[model samples]
Target: MPSSNKNLSVSVIIPVHNGGESFRRCLSSIAAAVPPPHEVIVVADGDTDGSWCVAQEYYTTVLRIPVCSGPAQARNLGARTATGDILFFVDADVTIYPDTIRQVAIAFSCEPEVAAMIGSYDDAPGAKNFLSQYKNLLHHYVHQTACEEASTFWGACGAIRREVFFAVGGFDNRYRRPTIEDIELGYRLKQAGYTIKLCKSLQVKHLKHWGVISLLRADFFYRALPWTELILRDRQPLNDLNLQLLSRLSVISIFALLGAAIASLWWTALLGGVVVFSGVLLVLNAPVYSFFVRQRGWWFALRVIPWHWLYYFYCGLAYAIGTSRHYWRQKKQLAFGN
Candidate 1:
């Protein structure tokens, strides 16, 4: 559907923290989008890398937070100062397609019942590498089949009615860290009887720049901790089947390597065969991994595959630790009635 001629004002809120070169590109893309946002709000969270200055050059309204708070807090701060009817939240690392704003506006206008809408990067072509492919496949598999009542919306390109955002009290500032605040907020919105629509047409190009170690560190600190907090607070079991599959894969791979090592003590050929077979299995799964890697090229795939497995392991371990800590803290709080 084409964009309506009616003026649908939208405030684009971008939270930045040492965003560097990517922030400028993100702003440029947003500016290029049709029916541009009424205003762009960049909430700079104690950016020491001169990101705030760069954002100021691109965005007219820049809100600077002295202390480096997480994106959740930064977004809330931006929303507080925004003057538009609709709030479009975009991560500094993501660039929206030219028609994104129009598509988002159309989706909201067409569906009065949808309190918010989420756009995916999976629609973009050329994400072919083992890691990128796997990432893309995961994105498509999870989101393409996502129910309207999903527990979380992708934070990269999500929009919500200003009223609905305020009604839900914005993102929970309690999350103080850069993690699953989006997921928690989505859960809250659903609890309040609001539906979130997934807009496949509103595509954003995500420049995911993570080598293996960096990715693992990110998962441990950002993703895992926030997820743990959410599961504990809501008492929701870790029921995501994908998590189970990862666990199984990690276990199987570890055992397979150990067996191969043991076999090698007696016969070098057996060990070599095991190693080759493992490599072949990973290669066979290359198509699945290509969805994530296609954007970075062959060099990234060569460097990232080994690290990805370790990253997943660290993520799982961190999640377990975080979950345990959360449960203990909750129990203590309940017992003391503080």
Candidate 2:
């Protein structure tokens, strides 16, 4: 760790496309941080909702593109324009804790070997709906409990060293949408032998509202499928985050439970399958049940079990689709002699 007394300037980068009120609130919270960021860069990727105008009101550098170029490109542009040593990437919908920047400073100062690091979303999410709450809280729980020795990165609230970021070629601009851009960057960083830490203590509040349909769709199509393709394409080891052994086991158990129920021509089979399924879910996800109970009480926790089951089902479905697509695409390429 570089213990030089020289101050570390932090540049905060936010990319927005019609972020509206939440974008303003994000900037306001950034301004309220105790230590404050050295520079705040807001890139408006075709702002039709007037967020660009709001960016001007804040004492921040504002960049604009005529067309919506997607978040990856916007963040990349912001990175190029950033003058600070540390590039802190924050989503337009996240509210930073007052000490967030200060905490980031401490982490970088204390761990010189840590080339990049990311923080988890705080327990308090802005959305009050069940779908939004469940999705956001699940994210918070996963990141908070994940191995501190992280193998991937999050763009919602992550920071990286400027030199190392550029060395990895920043973000692959070919990702026209959010997709797995940040996670891909993290994989590259890891391949380059740079260390990334999941700073559980540092946190921010997620303000994006997630409807049930939208959440499931995004999880399946945008995140899970693309992320699966990325892993297979890179031939990277899938031992981190949700792809861990325990998670895979849980998915298998859930599917077995469903299959046993569907094929329950015999009463004995149904009873045996249900008992085994209940035992497995209880044993494996005791901590998750505890989290639900703590967050929304015992009654709500019991009620939310079905929803979590649905989540597992959808995740497995996405994995199957992604796997099929990957092989199909490869077959097509082979046929074409590419």
What's each prediction's TM-score?
A: 0.76, 0.95
Candidate 2 Cα deviation (angstroms), residue 298: 1.2
lDDT of 2: 0.87
What is each predicted model's overall lDDT from 0 to 1?
A: 0.72, 0.87
Cα displacement (angstroms), candidate 1, residue 238, comes to: 7.3
Global fold similarity of model 2 (TM-score): 0.95
Report the C-alpha displacement of residue 312, candidate 2, in angstroms.
1.4
lDDT by residue (tens digit), candidate 1, 64-125: 99999889999999999999877999998878878787777777777677788887765443
Task: List candidate 1 stretches off by more than 4 Å.
Answer: 1-7, 122-149, 237-312, 330-338
Stretches of model 2 off by over 4 angstroms after superposition: 1-5, 265-268
lDDT of 1 at 274: 73
Tens-place lDDT digits, model 2, residues 265-336: 656558689778968977888888899899988987786788887877887887888889999999999999
Top-lDDT structure, candidate number? 2
